[model samples]
Target: MTKRIQHWLAMLVTTFMLTLSVSAVASNETSANSDNERLGESVVRQEITGFAGADYWRMVKDGQEGYTTSKSPEHGVLISVPGQTWYILKEKWMSPLGALAIFGSLAMVALAYVVVGPLKLSKPKTGRKIKRWSRFDRALHWSMAFTFLTLAFSGLTLVYGKHFIKPVVPTEVWGWIIYAAKQYHNYMGPIFGILLVAVLVKWWRKSLFTMVDIKWFMKMGGMVGKHKGTHPSAGFSNGGEKAIFWLLIFFGIAITISGLVLDFPIFDQTRRDMELSNLLHMFSALILICGFIFHIYIGLFGMEAALDGMITGEVDETWAKEHHDLWYNEVKDLPENQPGYDAAQEADKKGSASQNNA
Candidate 1:
């Protein structure tokens, strides 16, 4: 009986060992299958999405250019990371600030007009005409004015037209308007550069700063505050005029350089170069636009008879003496300003008038 019981115990132990081994093998097999399934899913996802995952995107963000048939600069670049930064700066910061600057200038001019009115002459007119500008000077002045105004309008349209003009016009019309503005801006830019150079050459001597200019500035050109109507002493150009002239020369050069970079992209300019030029161009333009607003105000409404010289190439003797006393004194005794010359001119005019009457 003991032998039979020992045999049954041995069989039961063998059976238990086999069961445990089978169970362990089954668990391992299940885990291995799960891992294989996950690997397969990853492969499928990569194929479907056509993306090489994080490392590929990281390369793109680093401005890594891929192979392409085109040979143009940055043509192979899938994404320009720096371009994104430039776009954010222009759209988010520069655009709004530029608008504010332009409108603010207009507002200030309006306020000045209300508060101070025009800078009228302290004395009555002498009825004697003094040559303030020669015929060539007048021609150059008007030409520059026309070109400057045209560029300003087109540039403003390019930068801020959407806010004011786009909404009011039909879609087709707006498209035409923007296209025309772009063309006008492009063609007129070189012309403006030429005029800018001419102006610098013509006026650098007169625009030089002097000790008298310092005093004139301290008195705020004798047109504001306690000095209002004082008609401060000035040379051919006042301190304010000198400031404007220099500003135009420096900023105008910047504008011209940047504008050339934009207008002619044939110089192997990369995307980064264009982006930088665009930002510089807009910034320089905004400053000039603001400065010229005050200039225009001075010409049109800030000073009485200010526009007379530009229009007729002449100003009254009283106008010259009150505004540009130094220059007037220097030129007052010229052949044109002599009593005999005035009499001769009067006689010629009367003779012509009598001929017409006959």
Candidate 2:
């Protein structure tokens, strides 16, 4: 019985050792097969994908059509060279140029104010007033003024708010502010356009250039040195006023047209048209802004009693005589000092002489 038990134990031990060796060999072969399959798959992937540099992007940029559900023709374009070029111009060039133009005008005005001082009246106020602007005139002036300023502020916020305002304000507040500015600008643009046309039409006759304007230009409207005491003869509008009017007419028209192009996209205008219009709108507005800086300065503080004309629809007789002698001559008798109105007498004599000659 002992010998039979020993023989069975030996057989079982040998069988167990053989089984372990066979399993090890099978495991090694399986691992090697897996590695070979992995290598093959990698090679196939490389062959299918081609090179991963310029060729890849080149295919994408060569007017490749992308899948989309939209029926619009432009929707399928994967890349647009014109659009990319416009983006670069707006970001890298237009934005910076606009900033410089605006700030440069401000600095120039400031320097002039410091060096030249206010253009003061050489004579004393007579305490008498003559009508300078009519009620309709004052209404139109103020309407245009306020509307233009609103547009300017909101438009500037759109352009520069991200760079200057975003860092200083809370993110939530900044987002709201920008959103509000855009809304204000979009709504007010058409209003400004209407008012501008009115202003140009109403002031056209008075703003016509004449030979007398040449002399006013030579004297710099008596705003320069040694000429400060010399009150150059001027009509209803001086040479400077004519220049401002023309600037407003041209630039204002350009701004209005371009703004309309952007405001209403229903005209089926192309992306290229919109891009060009935006460029024209922004740059034209920048130029107009420079002119506005001068206009605001003169109307508010640069010239004494200037705002009075626009605010009250009248000016003092002395103020009129100093700034606009020719216009004063026409309306001099309309003031309170009319009892001794010698201007009307002089005008009658001149009129009689001209009539006789005719």
Candidate 3:
């Protein structure tokens, strides 16, 4: 009986071990099949969408030209890689720096006004006026001033208006404003170039640097600190004036050339040319804008009667003697510098004005 019991127990144990091995094999096979199915799905997906999509964008980014019906320059190229670089430079770097320069100039002028005050004449006015700018010179000066201010306004609006003006106005109003600014900028650009050239021709000789100008600059034009009210001797164009003139000429020429390149694109300009022109235009314009801010401050508030010559084509005798003594002495004997010369010119001007009003 004991032997028969032992044989049955052995058979049962062997059968149980065989069943466990079969179950383990079946589970592993099922898991392997599931992994194979997933791998196949992944390969199919990659074949359908992954490689072609990446290649198309890579080619576009590389600026590879493709077949197209249009004959325009760069028309076959779907994306401009250089354009992205240009946008980053203009928007990220130039825009912020340009704004800082403009506002910093204004702040400095304001500080000067508060601390130093306007430069007043040391002596009383003589009541006798001397001719300085001619009628034609005054006309040209005013015309250029008007055109320049208009262009600056339009250009600034185009660059920064989206930040300030867009949010305040309705969509339709914003559209019109931007449209008008762009149109005005495009049309008036050439006019500014012509005026700039005219100014260079008219004033280049007077703007040349001289020894007296160097001395005048050393004295800070007698308007600051220990030199206050000193009334330093100067020629017809002082050091400061000469600096402003040359600055305008140099940057004005740059602005004009770059502006022309952007304004007229018919010469088959590549994308690179336009991008470079844009950077040059913005750099030149920002510098001039900052410089003119100081110039405007001096004319309007920094000095007494500084604007008289530009406005009336004459300045008081005391002004000429104090601010430009060398020039005063040179021209003192001229007919136009005589005591009653301004009265005679005024009479003639009144007659011309009356006729025009009629």
Candidate 4:
């Protein structure tokens, strides 16, 4: 019985020893794996020409620094590769801010097509033609839109260019890619600046706040579901849309002006100033990107058939009738297309006849 008890104890001890040994081996394996990932080499900084943005490159040959040390090493050396870079994570989506800008904006865009004012309509509305956009207005819009698009793509490249892309592309190829993005980002900034100025100037008059605008806000611009009625609207601009326009204008000027200072070394900027501008540029741009998502939503989907006015400089008769009844009525009173039967021509003819009668 004593021998049997001793044998059982020996078996338990052996099992315990095996478990500890396996755990130790696993821990060492994990540590080794981490070490293997790092390029274990001494770094000797060397300057090289023909590298556009690279200030210095650490020399490595066959993954080792050739330099010899006579002294017995007590402290460990920091083994690093030549490249030091920040890349956006190549994950399912970007950060919360980035995802908001893309997804929220896109969702609004889809919803725009689905509904406009209300669920059911008591009456269909018509308006006189108010000029939707002027020639200069359009040119300004397109210029900024193009520049904004360019920035979006390049900015994305800066973020995600390193992670998913670097693996597939050789380092030499990726270096050029980054260099190109930087060059384009710099060159296009001035054009964006000009467009921002135009946006501020052209819309300043109408975009200003007024008492009527306050009231327009009070009633939420008569927007209802498909079934409800649309509220009375102003001639050219509605308060809600105009408010967004103003936000864009204000932020646009702020960002673009800041971008100018950052684009080149023109302004003798303090490190603090440069840092501030960098923050402003990135944060402001991020905000604008988010805001523009809604802007895009409204411009495309928020209003029914809104994009046509931008293209051919006119909207569908049905669309104008539905969305801008009051404005449509006012424009139809003009002389050019006044004589016809559609709401616009009828109003104009009536006005002309009235004047003739008078």
TM-score of each: 0.81, 0.77, 0.80, 0.59
lDDT digits (tens) for residues 144-166 of candidate 4:
88899888677667766776578
The Cα error of candidate 3 at residue 238, in Å, is: 0.3
Residue pairs with backbone overlap in model 2: none
Models ranked on lDDT: 1, 3, 2, 4
Tell me the whole-model lDDT of each prediction, alpha carbons only. Answer: 0.92, 0.88, 0.91, 0.64
Ranking by TM-score: 1, 3, 2, 4
- CA lDDT of 261 in candidate 1? 99
Model 1 misplacement above 4 A = 1-48, 51-54, 339-358
Colliding pairs, model 1: none
Evaluation by lDDT, superior candidate among 1 and 4: 1
lDDT of 2 by residue, 1-358 (tens): 9999999999999999999999998998999999999988988766656544556557668766667898765677778778888988888999998899899999988987998877888888987778788889999988998998889999999999999999999999999999999999989999999998899889998999999999999998898787776889999888998999999999999999999999998777778889999999998999999999999998887998999989987788788898899988887766334644465677888899999999
Decide which is better by lDDT, 2 or 4.
Answer: 2
Among all windows of ten consecutive residues in candidate 1, which has the lowest summed lDDT?
47-56
Worst 10 residues of 2 by lDDT: 334-343
In terms of lDDT, which candidate is stronger, 3 or 4? 3
Question: Could you give me the TM-score of model 3 versus the true structure?
Answer: 0.80
lDDT of 3 by residue, 172-238 (tens): 9999999999999999999999988899899889889888988888889898979888877888889
- Writing each residue's lDDT as its tens digit, candidate 1 over 11-100 gives 999999999999999999999999899989988888645567667767877989988999888898999989999999999999999999
